[model samples]
Target chain A: MSELAIQTKDISMSYGDHVALDQLTLNIEYGEVFGFLGHNGAGKTTTVNILTTLLKPTHGKAWVCGFDVVSDSLNARRQIGYVPENVHLYEAMTAQENLRFLGQLSGVEDLQKTIDETLELLDCKDLANRRVGTFSKGQRQRIGLAQAILHRPKVLFLDEPASGLDPMGMKMLRDLIVKLNAELKMTIFMNTHLIGEVAKTCTSIGVLNQGKLVHKDTLKNVMDRFGDDETLERLYLSLNTQKVA
Target chain B: MFASRYIMTAALRANLRDQTVLLIAGLFIVLVLISAYLGWSATATVQDVYLKVVEAYAAKGQIAPPNPVPDTPPLGLLRNMATYVALIGALAGLVLGNKTVSGDRKSGVYALLASRPITSSGIALGKILAIIIAITGLLGVAALTNVITFMILPNFSLSADEWFRLAQFYIASDLYVISFGLLGAFFAITSRSEAKSLMIPVTIWLTVTFIIPQLTANVLPMAALNPLKAMAPAPSGAFFVFTQSVLTPISFAEAYRALAATLLDFAPPGFKFQSFISPMLTLMIVNGLLISAVVVAFGKMDASRSAYDD
Candidate 1:
């Protein structure tokens, strides 16, 4: 078993009577692109929030990069980069300025160089000087990706990273995720419902339904169990329906 | 250190971007100008009243007038302007301070800033510094305007002592306003909505600056038992009787009498004390307590909690 970059043991979160995440246990290995597949309100964002140290778990424990998510949050935050579902950037600021601000907060040394490289990596060098408010959704998503990877974090928690992007933009993001995983050897923990993107990018996948991880396996294992004849979407539906029965 | 500087810069930028701040500054300038004009007029009225009273006494052929004629000069106009300018400075401080924290919450900028690595105290202090800079800039302009207006006025002559007194009053009044305004900001930061935050400060200002002072002036028996009167108690041969009559919860009245006796050149014997404390000491202590309370409340607030959440 490779070293686990993220480990959660029976972690649970509740907002009053609503259970956002219920005793969810997950382990993601280093350098693996793990796709978290779930419908809306399936606790994917909540799990990502907990792993990124944006939120505290109501119960159980979570660790990222060998530091407790709650007790050693500063270390955990330093180790992981987070891209929220919506690419919320300061609209008034230029792409370069936005990246610089986030980079500084992340304690990135050689901030200017990092911003340049990240912008170039996202193929957004031309738009760097333009205000982000003028950018398209795809451009904003790219900028969001650049900010997330600027600090060279060990793990990246991308909550719907391809959301609101056009087909071409989605393809570009898929390619970028693969490149990050293969070349950088960085763990990508992505939450998405786009099975096509998952099929292309992720090596391992987990299916979450109603705050429970119903399936966790490699693409090969999932294909073998459900057969290559059937699509992953159909297999996911059947599995979920079976659970309902 | 760099983070604090960055935060301060960001706060200043936000203030500049806010249209409401600009509007408030414009209104404050108008108020200052109007008040300055009114002050000039009021001082002219005082001069006319003095002249009339002197004329009335002259008709009686009294060689030595009971009251000296009040001087009407540019110096007096400047002094009047200074008083109105101080009030304007206080209003500016209050408006800026109340807006600093509450405005952030209303604009949703507080949440964005809180998501960063900065603490609540840092954010609060940065905002306070921004408002201070804004208020100081506005007051500087008003002061310059006052100086120019004084230079244009006829017979305007302000000695160094007069200028210093005006400056002293401005500093003290601005500090007092900022302190209370910060307290209001703290309240706004912890309140559910901006309306409540604004209301609390306005209510406190009305009570402390207007209502309480009026109540103290009218209800406080110290005025009737003037210290000057106590110094001349022997005119009625009732020194001991007057002292006993004035001895109750109105110790301040007696203290004022003692103070007058000490300051009066013709005060009788046996009324002097070796050591005397001024009432300004009590005011200083009260101001210190209010400021400390505001600082403590500001320090304890959590930047992460939304205004509606609180």
Candidate 2:
């Protein structure tokens, strides 16, 4: 097994003439809450897609938990779970029903028990029997999180996890992210434009602008060098501006 | 295989909850029942009129002509079922097929499914299997209705040979509708817009069910309702010959109706034994080809880009 939780080598993805992700290289250690900051269409989701084995990079390679995202995609997928921006599910089904379906697809053994434990772990056991369509955005996100981690994946990918959430919802998600990373020892890769959430939750941060990574460092080093969320925000803006220029 | 099993179960549950699909399928089964009732009633009505004429001949102390109702095949009463299956049953299958894929895409669950340890082909196969099972269930109801009607209604009992023919008719019907379902799923996977996903297959269904038959067999639109109606031979000409040669091979509606007419024992005189066998072959081949196309289209689909095209 690889020491790194996730690794990529000059992965490039293009749709026709437009490149969604350029030749980019990256790596993250196990158990790190790595925040990927990028403006809309900066290829954050695209990167997550590649890492989750939902996509194959046009040129180059990626590995998740030592498994190639392309050639060994099924094994790579077995290691990771992903929640997209909005986190839609079968609305007519209950939260538990949706979770069970996805968990079975993941080939989780002891499925019923795992579903119960995962729901309890996410602190949303009350929502399990309720229909997903009837739940609020916050409630749905909790179910989504439960579904993603049902198989106990080694890595979890979140794309705009905090989007459309109220403050309390955001806090709950942050707490869950922390719990999964700290207690479960799972590598967490988050894609978001919210630097505030990154500052609060991510241990390491990388800034991507137009498919290019401009800055990457540990949160402590970035905080000591750049000083606080306000200064870090400025640095983020400046990096994007420079990349655009 | 495990992933596909669960996927199929989930899809079946989701489809059952979809009101639109339920309504369409329910309507189809209802139509089949109604067609059977009407067939029984028509037989009774003709029998009543013939009895009245026979009594008048007996009162005059004259000979009565033979009863015409005996010539009508017991299964022929349900001939409207062929048309119903061709039109409404195919639509139900199409809608079910569309929902099978579009539901995942619209709900944004395609990414989740795709990211799982299952291959896209597995996902496609699971969904296709679900369609096959659902269509079979629908046609099974229609077939049962025919059997029950035959048992209850007088002058409608079938011999063992006819019973086997009825079963074959439904199996062929199931395949015909399933072909449309696969067509719908193929378009749903390949097309971006939900409307296009549904519309393209419907257009093809219309072309196959109506236009092609007219061009090749010179079948009038109404004549198609009576699967046993003898096609009026078109004027012998180059255009007619050319169309018959080109379109006949692809005319599944004609194939299906020919097969149904033969099975129901209502075929026109001089219906060849070869015609009976060829339609079934055509249906099986078309289904095989459609299944292959659908699996290939799904395997090539980009999962990351699979989102609702509103």
Q: All models: lDDT?
A: 0.65, 0.87
lDDT computed for candidate 2:
0.87
Q: Locate the minimum summed-lDDT window of 10 residues in model 1 chain A.
A: A236-245
Q: Write the per-residue lDDT of candidate 1 for residues A1-245, one digit (tens) a residue.
A: 22789999999988899998889888888988999988889999888877876567899999987889878766777777777777767666788877877677666899999899888777889989999879898888888788888888889889999888889999999999998888777899999999988889999998888888888888778889878799988987765545522
Task: Give the DockQ-based CAPRI class for model 1.
Answer: incorrect
- lDDT tens readout by residue for model 2, B1-310: 8888888898899899999999999999889878887977888888899999999999999989999887778877777898899999999999999998889988888988998999988998899999999999999999989888888776566899999999999999999999999998999999989899999999999888888877776454555666645355554778877887777777788888878888887777666422333888999999999899988988888888898578
- Give the chain A TM-score for each candidate: 0.96, 0.96
lDDT per residue (tens digit) for residues B157-237 in model 1: 566775664565444434444555565666666677777777776666555443432233311233222322333322233
RMSD to native, candidate 2: 2.3
Task: Look at candidate 2 and give me any clashing residue pairs.
Answer: none
For candidate 2, write residues A132-189 as lDDT tens digits.
9999999989888888899899999999999999999999999999999988888999
Off by over 4 Å in 2: A227-230, A241-245, B48-65, B228-230, B272-277
Angstrom error at residue A179, model 1: 3.6
Candidate number 2, chain A TM-score: 0.96
